[model samples]
Target: MIETMGDQLPAADIESFLPLRRCSILSYGVGHMLNDITSACWFTYLLLFLTDIGLTPRDASIVMLSGQVADGFMTVFAGELIDRFGRFKLWHAGGSVLVAISFSSVFGGCLLCQILGINSAALRTIGYSIFAAIFNVGWAATQVSHMAMVNCMTLNDTSRVALASCRNAFTMVANLTLYGIALAVFSINDAKTSVDIEDQYRWIAYVSILIGCCFVGIFLFGTKEPRLKQQHCENNQRVSWAYWFSKLLYYQVALVYMLTRLVTNVSQALLAFYVINDLEMAQSSKALIPALIYICSFAVSIILQEIKWNGWRLKAFYTTGAILWIFSGVGIFLLPSKIHNFMYLLSITTGVANALMTVTGISMESMLVGKDLNGCAFVYGSLSFLDKVSCGLALYLLESYQSSPSSEGCHDITSCQSVTRYGSGLIPAACALVGAVVTYTMNLHDTTPKSLSEPLLA
Candidate 1:
C-alpha cells in the first residue's frame, strides 16, 4: 500500500515511499497519446462524418448527446469499480481493447450502410447512434481507469507534474498525427470539393486498432502500481453515494476544474463548424488550426515547468487563462470573413490559455485531494460526468438553434454570421467569465508541500 498523510507514517518512513519510475511514466504517457488519438478522431471527425453521410445537423447532435450521456453514467460506475477492485492495469488494458473495437464498429456501421444501399437517413442515424453509445461506454472505462492510475503511480508532486508534462507532450504529438491524417483523408479536390472520405475512415479504424493494441500493451507490461498503505483504512470505510455527491459539490477546486473542462469541450465541439462553415476556410485549415494550437500549448507546457510564478496565487493562473480565452473568443467574433490568417493568431492565444488552465487545474486537484487514490478517481469521474453532460446540452442547444428555420439566413455565410459567432465566440467567452469569477471566489491560498493527515472530506 502506498503511504499518504492519512497513513500517519513517520517522517523517517517517508523514504520508504516508492520512488518515481521513468519507464512507467513513459508507458503511461504513450498510452495516453494513443487513447487521445482515438478520442480525438471521434470528437473531431465523427459528427462531421455523420452529417456528410446524410444526417442533418440536429441528427448528428442527438447522436453525440446520447453518447455523452451514456459515457457520463459509465464514468461514475467505472470510478467506483476502480476504487473497489484496485485493478488499474486490468481495467486499463481491457478498456483499451473495448474502446478500439467499439470505435471501429462506428465506422464499420457506416460502411455497412453504404454497402447495403441504405438510403433512409433515419435508419442510418439509428444505427450510428447505437454504435456511438457502445463506443462511449468503452471510452468512459478507459479514461477513468487511466487517469486514476496516475496518482496511484506516484505521490510526489514534482514527479506527478513531470508525468503530466510528459503526457501533455504526447498529447501534442497525437494532435499532430490526428490532424495530419484528417488533412490527407479530407483534402479538397481541384474543384474545391471534398473527396469521398468513407473509405479513408475505415482505414483510420484499422490504424486505431493497431495503435491501441501496441500502446496499451506497453502500459500493461511497463507500469506497476505500488501497494497502497491505506488499504486497511479503505477496507474499513464504506462511503455512501450521498457522501460522494456532497464531496463533489462542496469541493471548490474540483468544481472550478470541471467548469474549465466543460468550456474546453464546448469549444472543441464548435471548432470544426467554426472553421469550415463560419470562416469558410479550406479543408486543410481544419488541420492547421488545431495543429498550431497544440504546438503553442506544447511549448507553454514545457516552459511552465521552469518558470516561477513570482508570488502570483494559484487562482491567478486560472484567471489569466480565462481572460486570454475570452480575448480569443471575442477575436473570433470580430475577425473578418476574408482574413484567414488572424484565425491562427486566435488559435495561439487559445492554446496558451488552455495550457495554463489545464496544467493548473490538474495540479490543483492533486493538491486538494492529496494522495487519496479513491478521492482522486472520484473527482476525475465527477469532472468527466459534468463536462460531458454540460457540453452535450450546450451542443444540442447550439445545433438546434442553428438548424431552426429562423437561422436559415446563416446558410448564406455572409448574411448571418450571428449563429456561428455566438456558438464559437460569445458563448465560450461567457463560460470563461463565469469560471474566472467562481475561481476567484474560492479564496484558496497557496501552500507549501506538507503532509495531509485528514481524510479528503474531513
Candidate 2:
C-alpha cells in the first residue's frame, strides 16, 4: 500500500517512488509552453482580428463562445478516453497536430478569401467559428492528457512541485514570447490603431504551425511514460461516473478553484479589447504591460514556493492576495489614461496577486485530490468543463453589452473609458471578492491526507 501521513509503505514499494529523469520533466515543460503559445496566439488576437475585418463584436463573441462550449464537452470525452487507454503520449502527439492544423486554418480561411478577392463577412465568421471548434477539440484532448501525466509521472511530492514549477516558468516565458511577436507583427506606423492586415495574420499562422509541430516532435521523442502498477490501473478502471460527479459537487476547494479560474479567463479574454480600444495605449506599452505582469508573477511564484506554510499561513496568503487583486482592479480603473509608469505599477501588483492566487489554489487542489486517486485526468477535465462554460457565458454577456447600439457613442477611447474600466476592473474585482469569500469558508482543517483517502460518497 502507498504511505500516508501516519502510515508507512513496505520497503518494496519504496523503489517505485523515485524521482523522474530531468529530461523527461523538461520535455513536459516544453510541451506545455508550446501548447500555451499556440492558444495565446489565437486568443490574444482573434477578436481584434475579426472586428478589424468587419465582423461585429457580438458576432465575434458568439464565435468564441461556440468554440468554448464545444471544447468543454470535448474535455469530458477526452478525460474518459485518457483514463481508459492509459496512453497520454498518443493523445498528446495526435492532439498537437490537430491543434496546429485547426489553428492555422482560422487565419488561412481569411487569407484564401483575400487571395480570391471574395469579401463575404458571413463566410469569414462561419469559417472562424468552425476552425475554433476544431482547435478546441485538439486542445481539450492534449490538456487532459498532459496534466494527468503530471500525477502519473511521480508520487513524490517534491518531484511534483518541481515539475509544476517548471511548467509555470515556461508558461510565463511563452506568454512573453507570443505577446512580443504579436506586437512586432501587428503594430503598424506606431499609431495605436487597429489595421486590417490579412497578410500579417497569414504569416503568423504559418509561423505558429511550424513552431507547434517542432515542439510536439520534441515532446513525443523526448519523454518516456511512467508505468503504473496493476492495482493502480485496476483502481482507475473501477472509478465510476457517479463517484466523480459526487466529488465534483462536494469538493469545496475545487469549486472555489474553478471560480478563480473563471475569473482569470474572463479577464484574459477582454484584456486586448480594453488595452487597445479603451485605454488606447501605445503598441510598446501593450506588449510591455503584459510582459511585465508575467515577469512579476514568475518572480513572486518562485518566492512563494520557497516559503513553508501550514493551514493558517495558506489562508493568510490567499486572503492577502484576494485583497490585493481587488485593489489592483480598482487602481486600474482609476489610473490616468496614457500614464505609462502608473500602468506598469498596476501591472506588477496584478501580477503579484496572480502568483499568490495560482500557487495556493493549485496547492489546495492537489491536497484535496491526494495521491491515492487514479482518475486525475477526469477530475481536471470536470473542472475545465465548468471553468470554460462559466467563462464563455461571462464573455458573451460582457461583449454583448459593450457592442450594443446604446454603447456606440462610447466607442472612442475618451468617451468609453468608463466602460473599459468597469469591464476590466470592477467586474473582475467583484468576482475576486466572491472567490475570497468562498476561500474563507473552506474547511482546510478537514483536508488532511487521511481525509483524502476516504471514498467520494463517504
Candidate 3:
C-alpha cells in the first residue's frame, strides 16, 4: 500500500504532467501566427488606409467603431458555436477563404468604381465600410474557432504559457515584418508624385488574402483534434447550453478580464486616433512605434517567466505595468509640439507602457485561469469582444467631441482637442493603475512557483 501510494504521488515536474503533443502544438503556433499576420497587416493600417481613400476622419471613425459593435454579439454566439461544432478546421478553412475573397474583392470593386466614374467620396466610404464589415465577420468567427483549438491543445498551465509566449512573440515579429512592408509601400508611393489609387490604397488587401490562403491550408491540413483522455472530460464533453449558461455566473476571472480589456481598448483606440489626427505623425512612423513597443513587450514576457514570485507575483507584475503606463502618460503630456527626435522618445515610452500592459495582462489571466481551462478560450473570446465594445464607445465619444465647435485641437495640434485626444490615451493608463489595485484586493489562491509539497509544476 505504501509503495502504491508513493508511485501515485502528484506530478512534481509541471512539464511532465502533460506531455506536449509536439506536432499539434507546433502546427497550432504557426497557424495562429500566420492568421494574426494577415489579420494584423490590415488591422494596423485600416484607419489610415480609409482616410487615404477619401473617407473623412469622422467616417473612418464610424467604420472602425462598427466592427466593435458587431463583435459584442458575435463573440458569445460564435464561441458557443465553436464549442459545439468540434470541427475547428472547417471554420478555419472557411474563414480564410472568406477573408481572402473579401479582401481581394475590395480592390476589384474600387478599380471598377474608378473606371466607371462612380468613385464619388460617398461611394468610396460605403465601399470601405462594407468590405471592413465583411472582413471582421470572418475574423470574429475564426477567432472563436482558434481559441477553442488553443484550449484543446494543452491542459498543462506551463505548456500553455510557453505556447502563448511563442504565439505572442511570433505575433509581434509578424506585426513588425508586415508593418515594415507596409511602410516600404507607403514610402515608395509618397516619393513619387503620381499615385495609383489601387497600388497605394488596396494592394495590401490582396497580399493579406494570399497570406491567409496559405495558412488556411496549413492549419486544415495539419491538425486533428485529440481524443479526450480524462474520464470526466470525455463524459462531460457534450456540455449542454444550459451548463455554459450556469457556469457563466461563476466565471469571476472572465468578468475581471473583460472589464480590463474594455478599459484598455477604449484607451488604445482613442490614442491611435489622436496620434494620427492631432499629432500628425507619419504612417511609417506610427507603424515603427508599435513595432518597438511589441518587441519590448516580448522581452518583458521572457523576464516575467523566469522570475520567482511568492504572494506578490500578480501584484508586482501589474503594479510595474501600471507604473510604466502612468509614466508613458506623462511622456505624452510633456511631448514637444514640433514633431522630431523628442517625438520618437515619447513614442518609445508609450510603446513600452503599452507592451507592459499587454504582456502582464496576459500573464495575469493565465495565472487566474490556472487548471479549470475547458472554457478558457471562450472567456478570452468574450473578453476580446467586450474590448471591441469599449473601442466603439471611445470612438463615438471622441467623434462627438471633435464635431463640436468649442472643442480645442479640432483644427490644429495645439488646441483643446489635442488635450482631449491625449486625455483619452491617458484613460487606459489610469485604468491600468486601477486594475492593478483591484487585482491586489481579490483573494485568489495562487501557487508559488516552487512549492515543495505541490504535486504539479504548472
**Candidate No. with top TM-score:** 1
lDDT of 3 at 117: 83
Taking the tens digit of each residue's C-alpha lDDT, what string does model 2 give over 21-51?
6666678766765577776666667766777
Candidate 3: residue pairs that collide: 408-416, 408-417, 409-415, 409-416, 409-417
Q: Is candidate 2 or candidate 3 better by lDDT?
A: 2
Q: Which consecutive 10 residues in model 3 have the weakest lDDT in total?
A: 448-457
> For all candidates, what are the clash counts?
6, 0, 5
The lDDT of each candidate is 0.68, 0.67, 0.55
lDDT of 3 by residue, 183-290 (tens): 667777762321464565456656555665665666677876534323225545544444434753325445445545644455444444455555556656666666
- Cα-based TM-score, every candidate: 0.85, 0.84, 0.78
TM-score: model 1 vs. ground truth: 0.85
TM match of model 2 to true structure: 0.84
Q: Candidate 1, which ten residues in sequence have the lowest lDDT sum? A: 449-458
- Clashing residue pairs for model 1: 1-227, 1-228, 1-229, 2-227, 2-228, 2-229
- CA-only RMSD, every prediction: 5.1, 5.3, 5.0
Rank the candidate models, highest TM-score first: 1, 2, 3
The number of residue pairs in model 1 that clash at the backbone is 6
Give me the runs in candidate 1 sitting further than 4 Å from their true place.
Answer: 1-22, 108-118, 188-195, 229-251, 305-313, 403-416, 443-458
What is the alpha-carbon lDDT for the whole of candidate 1? 0.68
